[model samples]
Target: MKQMTLKTTSDLSLAIAKDRFSRGTLWRFPARVPLLLLVTGLCLQMPAVWAQQQETPGKAAIPQESPFGTYGSFEKLLQAAQGGDADAQVKVSLCYGKGIGVTQDYEKAFTWAMKAAEQENAGGASIVAGCYLQGKGVEQNIPQAIEWVTKAANRGDVMAQYNLAATYYEGLYGIPKDEEKAFFWAEKAANQGDREAQCLLGVCYLTGKGVTKNLEKSAYWSQKASDQGAPAAQRNMGIFYAMGLGGLKKDVNKALELWKKAAEAGDSEAQYALGSCYAGDVEYYDPDKIYQNMPEAKKWLQKAADQGHERAKETLERLFHIKASS
Candidate 1:
């Protein structure tokens, strides 16, 4: 019998770390690849109003009748903000930062965001962290970015929790890699119904990184995110169904359905898996039922290869005798 060595979650963690160091972006995996990749943390930066909603659950309903609601003309927002309304400060900062109704001015945006942050507003803290992370209006200071983000996360800011989880998971921005802390933040965010965090937590449980290895738990969390249309979690769920892992019964049809959904969402890994399935290379499918469609295979494999999926490129050259460069 061939000894099957189970790859751990650390493999995924290290891949994420390397990808972050090189690309300064999120990690993505090739389709059907054994290793999992972390979802990019870029989505952690929510719009100011959205951030406010996530941070302050069950607060007074945001007034929609006011011209100075979460968003409005720059002049009115500026006037309200100048009057020291924390919510207005956030809107005015966004106006300056994005040039929605005014000229883009990072310095002014930072100033206003800082004012709100000083008042302990979660949205303000998140913006301040983002400015520091990207050096928008201030000099790039990774430590400061992390500090502000941490403040927001501690205050039940879901996006902040997700960002901190990604940061700790990959140890990006000069932070030390800590799987335990990553799991902590991810779990917090996941419990709050953050899809990305749910996916990360599922992976953690699947691989026993900062959590006990529990395939059932992995499936549970992945399903939650997948139901919410998170592509990564959908892909993970497909893998679980295909392999019959995570307490799921082997269901090729279900796996293919999930993979197709993820592939349509532009997940490179799902594209590759779909290609492999069409190519009749995936194990457990009946040989007679496996239809070899080279064109379909090439289509999806090309999509993955275009995204720099090394194995897809290799498979194209070696098996399909086609050069991806072409």
Candidate 2:
């Protein structure tokens, strides 16, 4: 039987961030969202309510939702917020924070978010944490940010849980990497149905980080996330089927099916995998003539190599004697 190496933790972190952007989540804390780029991995991007679900690559995701929700106007939203509607208060905060139907005012945003938080809104606590994290309307305080986000996570905010997990995983805020806490928060968000968190949890299980290495559990989470169109999980599932890991029988066709989905989603590694599969007669690389087409191989390999995937470039150079510019 043949086996392929799993992605390193940092590479997987990059994939997780890509997945967040793929979801089309939008938020602004005065400027760019705060994400620590450090040696300890787990990349994270905050998610908010403004953006729509992503539909296709290279296209505007979908129609952005109105910040006012059913109220249809900022005035109506503010009125509702003043009336102590926690959900409306959160929307009002976004209106101020993002300047949607209101002037950009981080102070007002913080105030509105605090009102919602006082009402015990989980999402509102997360918003307040972002304020502290970015120093948007509050003094930058990592401790306060962590405290607020932890509150949100305890209240079952999925994004807050995912963010907390990434923070601990990356040892952000100068804290030591705590794999146990990372796994704890990741499990919370993954179980609450976050695709990125699910992918992270799968990788954690696969690598025995904060848990025993359990291929079956890894496959279970990967399959769930892949079913939700997570490209990273799709690629992982493709490898699982290809190598007969996690109780799966080796099935090249099944592997191609999964890899094609991830490749179309713009995963360079998956594109390389697909191109490699379509190339002719490499030992332990692919099945026989059932999946050979040089044109398809070149097309996918070029795409991967364009993204600077070394293996794709090497394969194109060695097998087809073609130079792929990086």
Best by TM-score: 2
| Candidate whose lDDT is highest | 2
For model 2, the run of ten residues with the poorest summed lDDT: 31-40
User: Runs in model 1 with CA error above 4 Å?
Assistant: 1-23, 26-72, 288-290
Q: What TM-score does candidate 1 get on C-alpha atoms?
A: 0.79
Candidate 2 per-residue lDDT, tens place, 130-211, comes to 7877677777777787888888889887767877776676566675878889889889978977766787788888878788
The alpha-carbon lDDT assigned to residue 25 of candidate 2 equals 47
Per-model TM-score versus the true fold: 0.79, 0.80
lDDT for position 189 in model 2: 78
Q: Tens digits of per-residue lDDT for model 1 on 1-326?
A: 11111122333221222323344442111111110010112232322112221222222233344433443456876887798877677666766665656777888888998898898877678778888877878887878888988887887777788778877877766679799999999899889887777888987887787888888998899999889777767877887887787788978778778988988877777777777777766555545555678798788888989888776787777667878873
Off by over 4 Å in 2: 1-67, 281-283, 286-289
Q: Supply candidate 2's per-residue lDDT for 204.
A: 82
